[model samples]
Target: MSNYDITLPLTREVAAQLRAGDSVRLTGTLYSARDAAHKRLNELLDAGLPLPIPIENATIYYAGPTPAPEGYAVGAIGPTTSGRMDAYAPRLIALGLCGMIGKGERDALVVRAIRKHGAVYFGAIGGAGALLAEHVEDADIVAFPELGAEALRRLTVRDFPAVVVIDSTGMSLYESGRAEYLKSLK
Candidate 1:
């Protein structure tokens, strides 16, 4: 029930605080990067080029936001499917990315990798654009602007609401919830 502001170079204590099904209101600087950006990041890693920003203890939000309307910093920012980045996530985790914020369930391989490296996956509300946008106070593209919505944006968020879908221990709220429901049905 306690709230936390996760900053870069996250400590083990902070990572441990995040757990599946726990509601969290994250604040501070978060990086936005989706499937396309992930692909490019991997390419950069393979080429041994410096990353635009260090991923050490950083939390990456998997979203391809729509263009913000006039006067808004961002618009319709919602969590995209997390499975698309499964193959590339282990690389990012190895690079020191501590956690990820996105929607839906990730695969077993991704879950194993997340635990293997010490990272958490948060699930923000899916299809709640206006609600989610309210949390994003400011947004600016830091790199790969050419990718448009898929570009990486540096966002300052306030009380950004999210639920932990996968904790550092590899626990999954979605799967447990489904099992509970199915047990009730039986």
Candidate 2:
């Protein structure tokens, strides 16, 4: 595995170079969206309506942060379980979503879509919300204000840490790492 410092709005060229298990510190803009936001985006897509946020070359972080403390930009911002967003990922991937930041494993279909679309899935440290929030320089709700924390938010991050869980080539660190560990035990 290699370590990299990457900026967001990831392009295919940059994404294609990442491999499962690589460590990355991402800087730049990231969009927040969980299940509710994804559902709404899907609905908009079905209706042939313009999406609330631009999809092309976008990186969506699966998180619903708590209200910020008095002086902070954000609060306890951590990744939600990625599986909850699996159902909606492929459609978004097809629409040019280049990256995702979250925890847990994604389903096979999502993996395939990631590969087919030249995208990468990065896994954040799940319980490190407080630490993660420090990386967020700013946060603003871009859409769906009534959804509260589940609202779509644009976040500006600097040196946000994550690991490549799945790569553009369809490689999965979860599967590979598990197999390796099991083999070592035997």
Candidate 3:
């Protein structure tokens, strides 16, 4: 496993270098954004209004985490399903967003966009909320704080475990894994 402290807006070369099933520990700032937030973000972008947060070269985690208790930055933060963000992802990536972290698989369209935009997608443990929360050392709302859990939070994380789901070369582990398994039965 390699440790990466990469900032978002990753280049094609960077995306191509990542492979499915590769273990990586990411450290740096991450932002939490979910469906509602994505919709609002798109609206803001489309209207020529400044985005609440600068997404360029930034990594976003799709989640609606539990509220934090006093003195804690967050509570039981975990990745939500990646599919819900499909509509907004390509637009965000085109705006220079570098990576996405979520649970479950992304659709083919998202994979293509990631490859085209020099971005990567990572999968984190879906239901492991407690364990995931421990990794978020600091967090603050950079956008839409009124949305509560659905608000966008800027977080500083350490040793966040994830696997590359899609790489810059358009390689997808989820598809490959399924194909390999199906072929074995033939």
TM-scores of all candidate predictions against the true structure:
0.91, 0.97, 0.89
Q: What residue pairs clash in candidate 1, if any at all?
A: none
lDDT of 3 by residue, 30-101 (tens): 899999999999999899998887777788999888989887779999899989999899888888888899
**Lowest lDDT 10-residue stretch of candidate 3:** 1-10
Per residue, candidate 1 scores C-alpha lDDT tens digits across 1-186 of 345555544555687778777888788888999988999998998999988877887889999888999988899998998889898888888778887989887887788877988788999998997899999999999999999999999998888988888888999999876797899998
Clashes of 2: 0
- Model 3, stretches more than 4 Å misplaced? 1-13, 181-186
The RMSD (Cα, Å) of candidate 1 is 2.0
* Top TM-score prediction, candidate number: 2
Worst 10 residues of 2 by lDDT: 172-181
Note each model's CA RMSD in angstroms: 2.0, 1.0, 2.3
lDDT of 2 at 180: 87
What lDDT does the true structure give each of the candidates? 0.85, 0.95, 0.83
The alpha-carbon deviation from the true structure for residue 68 of candidate 2, after best TM-score superposition, in angstroms, is 0.3
